[model samples]
Target: MAESPKRDTRDTTPDPKGRTQDRLIEHSYDGIQEYDNPMPRWWLTTFALTIIFSVLYVLNIGPIGAGKGWIADYEADMKAFAAAHPAPSGNDVSEGALLALVGDQKALAAGKSTFDAYCASCHRQDGGGLIGPSLVDNYWLHGGKITDIYKTVVDGVLAKGMPPWGKSLKPEQLTAVVAYVVSMHGSNPPNPKAPQGELVTP
Candidate 1:
């Protein structure tokens, strides 16, 4: 039978700190001292949970809206919906007179501004021709009535360089401009351009 090891009893007594030698709670091997402090209540709960939740939340919400290009899929679906249901019409005006209101004073002023800005470049300040025909004279390339003039404005003779101003000017404003034009007939300006078309009575 093997002999039992000898026990050291001299160092088994309590130390000067009043704690029992058995309850010292620490034993240093090299240079590190470790205490047995209990885990804090709030730190274990709030801090630990917050860190864990943040990692999970980012994984679920990031990188193209939760997964592989889900945002692109959503945009494509929206475009398809818009194509399926187009925008509705907005204006509530009669087909023909729509252009007549362009003759209104306020509308005429607006049309006049548009006219001066555009037509005046060729027709000159007083409606006499620089390159285009005179607008102030009784002779007209098209008819001279308000409705006829509105048609001429809207459906310009593209064969000639005159662009259809209908898309640019509202019908009411076009009418006002036509009225102003008719009002200028036989104006006999000091520098009237030579007449070209057959004279037509309004």
Candidate 2:
């Protein structure tokens, strides 16, 4: 067989050390030139997070790092939120303003949400007020009325260490809670608290 030609092995490209692969811009006064290299993924993520935190920090502060009654503002906002959200009375809003909140499915749902959050601690999941009063029945310990229950929840009995919730909860939320109580009268649940006060038969 005839001998085959060998490929050229000699290096022809100049040793352009530190030069960009795409070649530097034609003009260069100082020692700066834009690169064609794509930005790294990690760098992009870091920048995005920095922007997000800046926005969050600004919302919680007034200026110069001062919170400026941030807590009070937060509490007020929460109250407004509760009122606007209004407990779902299952769209069953009936009766006058006081009793209107009661018997409504939506209002009951809202009441259930709030009751579980705060009352459940003292009063078991059932209407039985643990360390509190049994809510399963008509208990007149504090006159039972959509208004009475609402007032008690808001004003709270200082003697019982039940601090006023008016500052913590919106009026509508309180109404929803009372609505739930009214709905629970005479209902059965697991391990219901002993019947207390006047057995309010709904």
Candidate 3:
């Protein structure tokens, strides 16, 4: 009989440097085996850095974060803007000045234009009142004085539904609209809403 071939046995186990040999996982599928290897240190480091960066970014913005949040920043910017461009003073105008505009046909025309665009929806085109109280009647909800009317337009009645027009309307527009409203007093329209509020004598 021929002599049996000598069996050569060199260590197949992986060395401490992990370069000696590849270690196969115990499980196999369809005679295929996978090497048990760890992820590269560079790839893991990059993933960890991304997670840290995201956490820092969140903590620096919005209302929840450590930084002066977006709400505070927005409020500061608004304050600066208001300081730079101050609103026209309502107290400066006398009742006489506003009354004078009532006789000005040119002013009345502009006022009417603005009223038709904005006020007409609530107080009808004829000022007979629809959703709002009648302007043609002597009934005064806030007050009937021209100055009172000006304050109403500027400050608005929040309890009701009217919005403050001071910030939205230009100074001239506010003056003109108030003048138009004043001019409509006592000129009765065809069909008016039932009188509401305290009746004031002119």
Estimate TM-scores for all models.
Answer: 0.47, 0.49, 0.58
lDDT string for model 1 (58-78, tens) is: 555435335444555568788
Tens-digit lDDT string for candidate 2 (72-186): 5778888998898554343333336647666578878888999899888877778766788777766667777666776677778889778777767776777788778777777
Which residue pairs clash in candidate 2?
A: 88-106, 88-107, 89-104, 89-105, 89-106, 89-107, 90-105, 90-106, 123-130, 138-200
Off by over 4 Å in 3: 1-86, 90-92
What are the per-residue Cα lDDT tens digits for candidate 3 across 78-148? 99988876665754457999999999999899999999998899989999999998899888898889999
Error of 2 at 147 (Å): 1.5
The top-ranked prediction according to TM-score is 3
**Which residue pairs clash within candidate 3?**
none
User: What is the number of residue pairs that collide in model 1?
Assistant: 8
The local distance difference test score of each candidate is 0.64, 0.69, 0.83
Candidate 1 vs candidate 3: the lDDT winner is: 3
TM-score of 2: 0.49
